[model samples]
Target: MTSAPNDLAFLRRLRPLAARELRLALLAGAVAGVMVVLQAWWVATILDRALVGREPLAELVLPFVLLFGIVALRAASTFAAERLGFAAAMRVVPALRRALLGKLGRVGPSGAAALPTGEIVAALSDGVRAVEPFFSRYLPATAQAAMLPVGIFLVVAPLDWLSALVFLVTAPLIPLFMVLIGKGAEALNQRQWLRLQRMSGHFLDAVQGLASIKAFGAGPRMVAEVGATAERYRRDTMAVLRIAFLSSLTLEFFSTVAIAIIAVLIGFRLLWGELDYRAGLFILLLAPEFYGPLRMMGTAYHARMEALGAASRLVALDALPEPVLASGTARPAFGDGIAIRFEDVHLTYPDGRIALRGVTFAIEPGETVAFAGPSGAGKSSIQALLLGFVGPTSGRILIDGHPLETLDPEHWRRHLGFMPQRPKLFAASVRGNIAPGEADPDDSAILRAAERAGVAGVIADLPQGLDTAIGNGGRQLSGGQASRIALARLFCRDAPLALLDEPTAHLDDDSEAMIHAAITQLKGRRTLLVNAHRPASLALAHRIIRIEEGRIAVGQAEPAETACPC
Candidate 1:
């Protein structure tokens, strides 16, 4: 394929996935195209019989019934084509979303952060919806426009070659104008998608930061800024509307001119006794219908352009290289006591922010270590590297004396139970939260873990107890309750290494009692890597390693302010 074809190949790539619906839609459209022809022919015959043939009304019943039947077929085909088109479009959107999300996972967590969360949400939701018109309207319309116009012209040709010649000449003008003008609309549509990305990002930011804005008494100012941005968006939108209107005006002008020229030619021919009234009238009716599909395509044309813009964006997103993942066994045993070491690691984010720089550390077997650092000190980056979300820009991370990259990340993670700073509770019950996504999770063990975490009593008080729905993201639970439940999951999970980050953050006094129990239970059997923010959490670790600006500051096992020992 040439460069032009290659660039837009993403649209073609979706064809097979939606072939079923598109075929149905195409069939409906083709049938509708033929129906319009039959409907027009029957109308012409009925009119000719009544007026020109001077036939009786009673004799016309069958003709009228046939015309109605043809009209009914046209309407049915129209509805079926529309319904099928929409169904195809609906299927593609979610399929696109799933494919995009799967791609995001393969890109890994760090690379996926290249786009803001709000932009991802918008692209997956509204941005994908913008392309809906292509499948639901444009594709079917294009098929109909392609087939119907030719059918009309062929039918019109034998009746009156002069009129067919007029159609032949006029037909190309609609798409011609559409293409020339639509080029501008296509550029505007791509810009519109970007603008939508910005709009969605800012709106999400505003919503998320509303509390801060209110507290700082800057709510009005923020609202004004959002309003100004919205106004700019509105102006951009109106500019697209102006082009559409101009294109519509151009199309209407040409269609009318084409029909007028045909009408004048037919009149002159009829007056000269060369053409019959029935044929002239049939040609008149057929002229608009001939132009009709092309006009429909013209109207639906922008939808195709908009979908193209979306496809272009999707192509760019897919162009991101897949994160290389090691293919290794998932059941790697931890019997040798999993050891972790970071040597001169460095990480620079896609936006050029450096999160890690020459960081070095090591954890021996059965060691309980705490990574003590302030926010943005590359604490999470170390964990991210170990988990293989990303590799170091320069340096290495070793697990069990082997390079971390050589081990399958999923398999490595399967051997470690981690609770990050933010606890994620699902829309399930207390027992469900205690053991999510485990192979054959034990209910009794879940309750035992919950008891150790000091939140089992709280769950027992709920109307449905362990089976009670926690609601989405555990909205029904307090922060302390949520934290305890997460800790419970760590307790119940049978991983050899437990990686817990600030696990006690949102706990109450009562919840802390359970934290102590869970901590004691986690002490010696499993190797523990903890990101601690409090003295109590820090005390659970055998050694404390402080990180500052991606470099190790001090180690509890060594002299104060000593460099990290790799």
Candidate 2:
């Protein structure tokens, strides 16, 4: 992952996606090169006949017409070549984004915990965008560099071997310098790219923590720090530009020298009467076209660096462990209610943190069980396993005597109405937030769910009632109000099984009382698995299961002495 290949695995990986696009682009470039040669021939023939052979203006009409036709063809072919290159880029970008997103989803929350959120976002967005040029410009430039020169060489060699030999010898040197300079630029570009990710991540973190910054009176300091970060990025960008300028200069210098050499050789030969003006003019016109491909290759070598920098991160993202969630084939549906059993379940995260160990428990049909544990005591881990967010490292979770993995995850989730510690609400109307996924949404059902969750009074107080825009993350609502709104979503589901984690957590006394009332409404109507440590919350449970470390205690129900830490 550090190296683009460690050998050429990156190219091998890309071949499948880009092969067809690149082939079409290359074919189009070859055709364009043919047009360039034909246009050069038409122009050279017309000039030779009029200037040297002393042909009348009327006699030159055929050559002039052919030259005009060739010019038009060249213009059309150039347009086609550009369009073909862009089409190839378009083919790969979306596929790459989809595959990356799918892979991240599979990794699950636990698997992705170590990565920075902003960097992941950048990689999926801007990082992916930066690579578009690699396909549209770099790959086509590469194809033209390889194919165009050979076509030009073939035409020139027949007309004049000396000029062709000069082209063949000079073409290799341009790329030689390009490779040597590019080796150094690759590392610099990669370093700058990684730094940009860190800067972006820091900015995102600052935005998310803006409230805390204002409370702590660090807003000005944070702004200054952000400015410093941007300044550093600017420096890195300047360095990249400097290297790019040097690369272009080297290419331009060498190509100019090669063209000058060819023109000099043609002039000497024409003066000695060893070459006809017709053939001499043709070779002279072709000399720059011959090196055109090499110059393009030199420019595109920088694109290679840009792509490799992006690809290194892509490779690293791809190299992460496979997703822990298993997608079972059989469609799952609820009947009555589900009985659950945990058989020797264990959980370990990527950073070697163990969350559960040899734990075992069960709940019969329609039973309401509460798991009480302190922070990091495997309470949430159990919920994660049951919800199909992440699989246990070992052992099995059986639902109604059937292993959970035997059921399709999407179908299994439909039977669940889960309310996590902090349920997310989008920037939508209260009704939309309450009933997000229904194919045909019902206004009455949304209002009913809101009323049942004891939050109808809160929403009714808003300016627009159910039609009010909540703003991003439901920013307009208080903590208790947000919790009540999430509970409303669960009421809307009315699924067979409900998982509520710290349902009243981080809420004011009023909010806690509201959620407690909602829980009172849900009892016996649905099977509930609640994770809590609050005496208020634990008091609502029919049975209490204590979790210490990763294992369940061997005792019966007990009163909550303190909040959490069971």
Candidate 3:
């Protein structure tokens, strides 16, 4: 398919990453084309001398040896071209993956603008892989198609201008018809990619929520739904393949017909004694060679369509609104806990949903503060601002007497221990989950953290203790168990500033007590901000900040003995 201008431009932007390898591949392909001409000339000359001139085998020995060498060199050049093309594609794929992943990372914990998890996965894995063939095969073949046929015609024109005329006349038809057939295939390919992405998203969602489906006894319905998505994907894939086969057939038909026409003409002229036998045979040999690159181009054209379909998604992902990170040079000192103050902070999401409105509060260093609010009352919004996920639409936050906007986010985050309401666990051993990024954390340290989070008993009951592998998102564990594991991970971090969003959410009373004990022990050693709903959890705070409708209804220090009234 003819690529859209933006698709082509996107490809051009990535070309420089592997420019040297791509140039070498093109050089190798050109050498192979030159060898094809020389090989044909040698074969025609040897045949003419040995058969028509009745030359001795001994006299033709040098030419035979030279022809063999040409064939060997041609094969070697072709191999080099293939290897170099693959090398270029390999280099380009990693760079593209890195760029895509970095873009995703910048989206932060707030979510990738509501991008589907499956779509993100497909783009990073399947989409990036799809681009490989465009660089490796389609691009080099296109370059060869543009030059090789013309070079062959230049060589043949001197010997037989009619054959050169045939080559010139029929060459444009290959790409003309290729485009005609490819236009239909391009749409099919695009649809196929889109269907695949939807299918991936559906399947991922189904798997993640399998427990709910099972509880509702909707397994059969989910199965049917997933099957329908798979079937649609299969049909679209087959349709794309059908177009590919048709395009290949069209190319072969045109090239074969063109070669046949040249053959018939050369045979007739030779029989009429109007052409020399060697020249006639030479033109005949070069005819197929003239169409070879064009045929190769036709075969690699499907890869181009696939890459474009994938690239459209990738380019769109890159075009997604990314959070503009603060370019602050100042680094805040969090050694003795962090003093945070929000001075009339306001936060509005991209979708025009205001999460915070004129919210203002302050927390002293090493103080334990709790934000009490119903869901969507800007409690988590305050935590989001503190985490630097998104900058305030208007107003400022101060960190240790310094404007929060002036502190480097990456540096500021390094000292933070955050636990979101729906905590995520990696597919790793229980030990690994407790101490993420630590290759071989101290078992005693892991034990201490687990004990603090109250998951020590749960770990002991596991078949393999801390070495048990929790599947993706802790599928092997219950929600409460996973939440406790996340809490343990927070304790393991031991950062000076801890932000726990509903740390006791979705937990049993027993599990809640374990975590409460952990937080109580952690108090006065770090700056703590928690979004708490249960009265028992709010009681642990030295101060309770009540929020309602994005405004602070009350910000008062409540003695532990006093009950908090929401």
Candidate 4:
């Protein structure tokens, strides 16, 4: 498709996945509609026979029993429709969530970070949920509204054509007015969704940066900003709700007026002796039943508006490109370790910031190389490129004599162990954090990795040892301890190429020494690419490549001792 379709079109595309369940729900609703006609027929017959014909109460027992049975069956069918529709909606919500998460993964880190985290969270949580009612209530109600009113008119025409004419004339008014009012409600709902997204993003940003705000004594200012955003969202919500109430009132008023007109017509015809009592009563009994579906449809129409608003946001998110570059199908073997070469590599981010310019570098197989530079000197950018988190804007990254762009990113990453500057730890036990990817982790292997990373003694000191819970984001541990745990995780991977980006930065002397020792131990066993600033860390590298202002400083790629020292 050249351009993505609108929210309604997007919803239509997803209909096939839950077609069977939705069809069953429609079938149940049709049964309920038929029961409505039959129940009204039996009720009118029973009332006419008892009061107008002077029939015995016992003579109407069968009709009363049949009417009760019809009511029960109608109730059952309505319940079945509701349950089936809900089932269909549940199926759809999870599929949408999966598509969103899969898209998030394919976009990689840089692309995901480009979107607001709170807005993404809102889409995955509330946005997907708002769509449920469209499938569960709105779709079925529309079908019922279409089928019920026409069926009631057909039944009434043979008995009282004048009442049937009134039904025909007034029936369309409910939906016509429904459409008119719904247009305004839909716009309000869309604005409400946008405001909610802004509020969610602002609140999340404020909470995440609470520590910094407190440190800078900006707590009151931050709170006021958050309150303002929340207030705006609340006002948007109230406006939408007001529109919804108005729509409901308009539907009720028209349907009630139509029923009253039918009642008045039937009364005048009976009073003039032009219509039989039984026929007039029958026509009157069916008036409200005819308009019942229309009123229900009006209420459900609000759900459609809410769903359209939510689906619009979801569609916008889905339209973003997964990766700036498509990953190739090639999986190159790194039998003799990965030999990488950057040929005049240039890196520019989506935000128009140039990270690297004409930066040339090479890493020999199983070599320990350090990229030493000040902050924003392209060291981390190089690591991001190597890890396949992103591609070079205009350059070539070759791996083991194969073009990096031509290699499958997933397969290529399997051979590399990466330790980022700030590593994330899940809410799991310490042992689980160390070997997060292992299906059946070996206790001995984990202990060995932890010991190599110099965290085994620290783990032993905790009350629960390796099984201690780290809490979300490793909150139970200190920064140094968390870093060591991440290093241990890298060791457990046993990959051929190990990338450590500023592993010792911001660490205490003890933590730094422990990491340096781990580096010394793994220097020859694997190809090591480290981004370091401390002289001691740089000394471990066989060669140091110093970068400055998006380019390699001349005469800086040499022995570590002669390279620029921090």
Return the top candidate by lDDT.
3
State the TM-score for model 3. Answer: 0.94
- Deviating ranges (above 4 Å) for candidate 4: 1-5, 52-54, 324-327, 330-336, 358-360, 401-409, 437-439, 552-556
88-142: candidate 1 lDDT, tens digit per residue: 9888888888888877776777877777776677777776787678889998988
Question: Which candidate would rank higher by TM-score, 1 or 4?
Answer: 4
Provide the TM-score for each candidate, comma-separated.
Answer: 0.85, 0.94, 0.94, 0.92
Residue lDDT tens for model 3, 1-566: 22467876787789999999999999999999999989988998999998899999999888888889999999999999999999999999999999988776666657476677788889899999999999999989998898789888999998888998999899999998888988898788788888988999999999989899999999999999999999999999999999999999999999999999999999999999999999999899989988989999998988988888888888777776654444566875677588888889888997789998997888899999988889999998888777777778888888889887777777887789998888889988999998888866999989999988888999999989999998878988887788889988888888899999988888889878877887887799999998989988888888788888899885334654475556
Q: Report the lDDT tens digits of candidate 4 across residue range 163-232.
A: 9999889988988999899989878888888888888898898888989999999999998998998888
RMSD of each: 4.2, 2.5, 2.5, 2.8
lDDT of 2 by residue, 1-566 (tens): 28765313663465568778777777778778888988888788888888888899999888788888888877877788788778877877888899889878666676666677877877788777777778888888888888878888887888888998898899899999999999889888888878888898999999999999999999999999999988998998899889999999999999999999999999999999988998898888888888888888788788778878877777767666753445575675666567899999998877888989988888766767788877888999988887776778898889877788777777778888889888889999888888877767788888899999988998989999999999878999988888889999999988878999998888888889989998888877778889987778887777888888988876734533333444
Q: What is each predicted model's overall lDDT from 0 to 1? A: 0.80, 0.82, 0.87, 0.86
Least accurate 10 contiguous residues by lDDT in model 1: 556-565
Candidate 2, residue 275: the lDDT equals 89
Model 2 TM-score on a 0 to 1 scale: 0.94
Order the candidates by TM-score, highest first. Answer: 2, 3, 4, 1
Ten consecutive residues with minimal summed lDDT in candidate 2? 556-565
- Cα deviation at 289, candidate 4, in Å, is 2.5
TM-score of 4: 0.92
